[model samples]
Structures are given as structure tokens and as C-alpha cells.
Target: MTNRLVKHIQNLLPDFTAGEKDLSPFITTRVVKKDEILLRENEPCDALYFVARGCLYLYYEHHAVKQVIHFALENWWITDYKTFAMKGPAVYSIAAMEDSELIVINRQQYEALLNQYPMVALYFNTIHERAYGAALLKQKTYATTTKEDFYKYFKNTYPDILARIPDPIFASYMQVNLEELVQLKQSGVS
Candidate 1:
């Protein structure tokens, strides 16, 4: 496997020890083809994944409609937090938006690493904190921003993701219908 996992960890924890570096070897890697579901709702979420390449969509389905919560692009870590931590069925499913390279760390190994290195826990905490902050921001955007404003913000923040994801999926992510998305696109709203 490539050392992308180690490089990401080292980037996150610059002061890590040699032993900590060794832990990266145990991180598993997998390839997911586009549209493949990496995780399904109601299944156990034993692992979290770091996106080495391509993208994954995190979503919940309601009335057969996908409600996109997040997009995991390269360098992003993704997992069903409640299920992964508390041991239960996942509330969301993760599917590959494009052929993807992923590095995975199962719950057991993650807990073991935290036990051996408190700072590793801190690193993960920071990751969670940022995710939480983004979620809050997303909520605020939905509540306060106009559709045009939201689209502009999304484009500014995730130009790569916008370029790659399909129109319907991108519309779902924005909580808008396909027609609305097309109208917005046609309007050339920045």
C-alpha cells in the first residue's frame, strides 16, 4: 500500500513518535468503484475511512430520496460517528461518487492507538470539532441563505466537488430540486 495514510497522519500530528508512525502500517486500504456503496444504513460502522483519491457521498434516504449530508473528498475522514463509537447500526450510508482509494482504521485499532497515545485522541478530537463546526455552518446556511447565496458559497468552498458530482446529487446536497438546480445554473449565479 502507498504511504498516503502515514503522510496524512504525520501532517495531522507532526510531533508523533516512531511508534506512532508504525501504526499507519496497520491502516487498511480499499478501492471502491464509482456508485458502489461503501457502507449501508443499518449495518455496523466498525471503521472510519480517509479518502486518498476520488470522492464518497454520505447520505440518508427518506422516501427514496437521498439527503446528502457530506461529501468526503481526498484527505477527508468519514464515518458514521454515533454507530462507530457506540456500537450500533449506522444511520447513514456512504457511496462512492467516483472510483476511490480509501485508507481505513477499524474501531479496535483506533481505540488502541488512543490508549497508547493521548495526543492521537486529541488529533481525532480536532477532526470531529471541525466536522461539527461545518455542520453548524451548513445548518446556518440552510436557515439563512438564499438558494443563490448557498450555491455561491458551496461553489467557493468546494469547487472540485462541484465540478465532479452529478447535477442531481449536487442538487440533493443543496436541498434543492433538479429543476431549481438547473435554473440556478442557467442563471449563471456566482
Candidate 2:
């Protein structure tokens, strides 16, 4: 079987390579149903998940409400990095937003791969840098923009993601109300 995760890594850095043979021993591919929790809040989180197909989300419950941190669409990665590094309980829960195929890597495997291949380490460093940049950009965008501007920016920038995610989750991610998102959707604001 073609390993999509391996392919994604190779695409990022064609010079230094990690093939299926190198990663197969350290990874597990799983298919999960929608709403199935991969990592729960306050639970041990040992794996980093890569989305092969379908969608996943990372969120935390606050005052009995779920506040979405981010979504992982196809070719994206999702995990509580704090837990992955510290080997502590997860701060956020990760779950399938759709029936999804995931590539999972435990910490040991993560360490082994990083040690075994310089390219793999570079691959992850690139991923982390991009992730961090995105997080900061999202923060800045949210802080600087008005609600409607934020909504418009999201609609314009991530039409695919906007289309795939459910209303409630999207609202949570946007920190907007569902009715408002509905209105925005119908408002032809884009």
C-alpha cells in the first residue's frame, strides 16, 4: 500500500528521504468513525496522528463547552504537543470529525526515527515551524480582525475546510455563535 504520510514527507524534502520501509515499523494506520475520540482530555497521549484521509479535530472542554483549537484535514497532523513531549496528560482531545484514516506514531517511534534519519528530523522541524507560524498567525488574525472580517477571511482562505467542518465545530473554532455563522453563510458576505 502507498504510504501517504511517507509521500507527504518526501514531497516536503526530496533531498533527504524516509521511505515506507523506514517508517513502517514505527507507525500504525487506523481507520476511525466520526466522533470517535483518539485522545481525550486529561488522558495519556502517546501518539502523533497524521491524517491520511478525512478530518480530525483538537479541542478542549471549557465550562462544559468544547472550544476547538484546530482541525486536521487530509494531509495534516494533530496531537497535543505538550503531552507528546512531556509524556503527561493531554490538554486537548483529538477526535475524528469524519470517518478518517490516520497514521499514528508513538513517542518512542518518534525518537527512534529522529535519531535514525537526519532527513526525518528535518521533516519534523519544518512541520513544527509551519505549525507554530500558523498558530501565531491565527492568533494575530483573530486579535486584529473584526468578527465579520474573520468570518470572511476564513471563508475565503479555507473554503474546503469551511465546507467540511460542521457548524458547531466551526463556530467553536471561529469563536462565533452557530446562528451567526449561519447568518454569515447566508449573508453572501464572501
Candidate 3:
């Protein structure tokens, strides 16, 4: 698992120096069962998780309804950035969609790594920027497109998600009801 963690970091940060690789000793792995809640709302998030296998979803409860924010699949990172950075309660909850393996770096360890290896911060910053861009694109797509078009675009953009995610969960993530998602599927949007 340590070797896997090191390899993952090396692949992600191709420019990592020998000293940066030394930080790998601080990363740890966790195996979460299906439906396991990794982070609950109102609880501080201690670590940023990198999904090594399977999937997890990040969501928030709104008027007792769970609204999905995003899904983290293999090689994706999951965390409430605000909560993690500020040491505050999370605004969202994260749960495993299936049995999952994750590599995690807790806040303190991550900070120490950053202090020791400034270049490593660039890797995190780059990924964060990409995530923000994807979120903005999704928001724009949702705002401008009809449900059918959105579904089609989603299918095209995230074929792996279409193949792996359950319909109801995927519908929730798209902010659509199950029936609507079913209708779109049956209508041959994909």
C-alpha cells in the first residue's frame, strides 16, 4: 500500500524531488465498506482522500433531502476544502458508493509536506483549479441546457460514471428526479 501510495504521488507530481517522495511515508490507506460515511455533516474533516478504488459521493442535506454535489471515482480526490483548511465542521457528507480503497493525508501531515516541499503545493493547486473549472462548466451546462441535452452531455462527458453509477444516485447528482432520469434514458438521449 505504501508503494502504491508512492507511485500514485509520483505519477501525479512528475516533478517531485527526492525529498518530496519522502513525504509518502505520511500517507495512509483506508478500506471503506459500501455506504460507509467517511465524513459526516457538521464534523471536522481530518483528511483529504484519494480514491484508489471504487467510488464515493459528496452531498449535503437540504430540507431533509440529500443533494449530491459530486462523485469521486478512482484516482479522484475528496474533501470539503473549506472545512479541511479552516478546521471547521463540514458543510457536506461523504460516503462510499461501494467497497473502496483510499489513500489519505491528514491536514497536519499535508501542511508539513508543503512546508518541506514547496513544489508539491503546485500539484495540489493544479488539481484544485481543474476541479473548479469542471464545476463551473457543469454549472453552465445545467443552467443553459434542457434536461435531455444535459443528460446526453453528461453521458458523453462521463461514460465511466454512466457505466458504474446507479441510476437513482446519478439522477440525484444531476439534480433530477428518478422518473425524469428514467424518461431521459428511455428516450434514447445517450
User: All candidates' lDDT scores?
Assistant: 0.86, 0.88, 0.85
TM-score of each: 0.93, 0.96, 0.92
Give the C-alpha miss distance for residue 170 in model 1, angstroms. Answer: 0.9
Candidate 3's displacement at residue 175, Å, is 1.1
For model 2, give the 10-residue run with minimal summed lDDT: 1-10
Better of 1 and 2 by lDDT: 2
Q: Candidate 3: misplaced stretches above 4 Å?
A: 19-21
Return the candidate ranking by lDDT, descending.
Answer: 2, 1, 3
lDDT of 2: 0.88
- Write candidate 2's Cα lDDT for 1-190 as tens digits: 2278878887898875667887788888899999999999999999999999999999999999999988898888889998889999999999899999888889998888777776788888888899999999999999999888888998899898888999999999988889988888888888
Indicate whether candidate 2 or candidate 3 has the larger lDDT.
2
Model 3 per-residue lDDT at 131: 91
Task: Output the lDDT of residue 134, model 1.
Answer: 94
Instruction: List the candidate 2 regions with Cα displacement exceeding 4 Å.
Output: none
On lDDT, the leading prediction is 2
